[model samples]
Target: MHKTLEGVQQSATPAIRGPLQVYLVVLALGLTVTAPSRLAQVIAAAVFLGLAIDAVGVRPLRWLAVPVFFLIPGLAIILVTTPGHGLIEFGPLTITQGGVKTVLDTLTRSGASIIVLGFLIASTPVSTVIATLRRAGLPSVLVELLLYVYRAIGTVFVEAERMQTAAKARVGYSNRRAKIRTTKLIASTLFLRTIDRVTHLDEAMRARGYAGKAPATAEAESHGYGLSIGILAVLLGVRIL
Candidate 1:
């Protein structure tokens, strides 16, 4: 993971502990989905966005753009396909009142969830999150799977960087045509290599007498129960009123 994406790894003041952080995320998500109106959802997202920025600065927020952009197509689909009083028309496509409402609801729900999860990743390394989940009695199989997937993503990223560097040295992207061809080749090769890598990893784990469960990590004491409680309370208040 990039350093900028890694949130405050360590803080002088005790922040939300691992378990508490997980609980807060769950609670926030629950509140977000059940939020009665867009205003409530927006407030929840705003709070999380503030915390994320305060933890890691604004640079990491740029990643938020990726998810938001993806949501655009989904929103467009909902706008055209949903049936209701016609609000606008473009040739065969018609935007309906129901569709607009659905889009706003979807946007708020997705935006809130994404921002909350983004804050989690920014504040803690994924390994720590996996460990926290394992300790929280998340199924061992699921925890192990998450750990391996995280490792695999890192491995793939490094491999892709090496491949790109090698390609650049060979002038693989010297022209527009070359760039497209190089990208296509790299993607296909990367997929094949990833499969091979996963196979080797599985073999290695078996060689080590891999059991159904991975070893549990030592518990690290964390604080911030009060802060978590406060945040959850505020969200509940907003939902109720």
Candidate 2:
């Protein structure tokens, strides 16, 4: 299989509007608001804005499970823990307006951020993201680690899917007990398979004059620089005024 860093190629001339551009935009979005009230409003605005961007690229729903997972846990924990005026009561359990407020505020920002991140991940490949960072003068050791970790994630996901398919073929997950056992087996197998892959990869790298650091990448167009500035201006504008 061919390799491309998140989506950044090691070409003599890199393309405009690369993964680095998207990464910077997301970073700016994260920094826009400081207070929960305004931040929550901005987050809602961002979600709407991101939907426009999503139409032109990858929709956030392409990997709906991830956002839902984080979104649920954040609300769940905050509802029980945040202190506020009581909105409702359930015997020993109380639901306060303060708790509800905090949950909404946090979830809005968190969910909006996820929307932006989801778009970036879905549109760009992992290799391109790491490669772009490497080009941005990141430390060699850090870049190498990022590269390996991204590859490992892809490997694990693929392995898990394959095992899941195999299990289904054998009626391995027909019941809850069977499903739990199958899941445990898949996790263990995936771990061993990843370890084996890493060992061979190290050997291959060493054979090819592998060092602690990766080689340098080529330059890309600065076209996205202007685009990023405009986006930041817009985001900050909404947050400030």
Find the candidate with the highest lDDT and give its number: 1
- 188 Cα displacement, candidate 2 (Å): 15
How do the predictions measure up, each by TM-score?
A: 0.69, 0.58
lDDT of 1 by residue, 1-241 (tens): 4442323444312256565676687679888888888877898899888877777777645555445644777898998999999989999999999999999899989999878866765566555667688777889888787667655654455456667779999999999999879876776677567668877977887889877555545337666788788888888888888
Q: Spell out the clash pairs found in candidate 2.
A: 5-127, 5-128, 6-125, 6-126, 6-127, 6-128, 6-129, 7-128, 8-128
lDDT of 1 at 61: 59
Residues 91-137 of candidate 2: C-alpha lDDT, one tens digit per residue: 76778888887777776666565555444444445545666777667
Clash count in backbone of candidate 2: 9
lDDT for residue 9 in candidate 2, whole number 0-100: 23
Candidate 1 differs from the real structure by a C-alpha RMSD in angstroms, to one decimal, of 5.6
Residue 10, candidate 2: Cα error in Å is 14
For each candidate in the order shown, give its overall lDDT on alpha carbons: 0.72, 0.57
- TM-score, predicted candidate 1 vs. hidden true structure: 0.69
Listed per model in order, the count of residue pairs whose N, CA or C atoms clash below 3 Å is: 1, 9
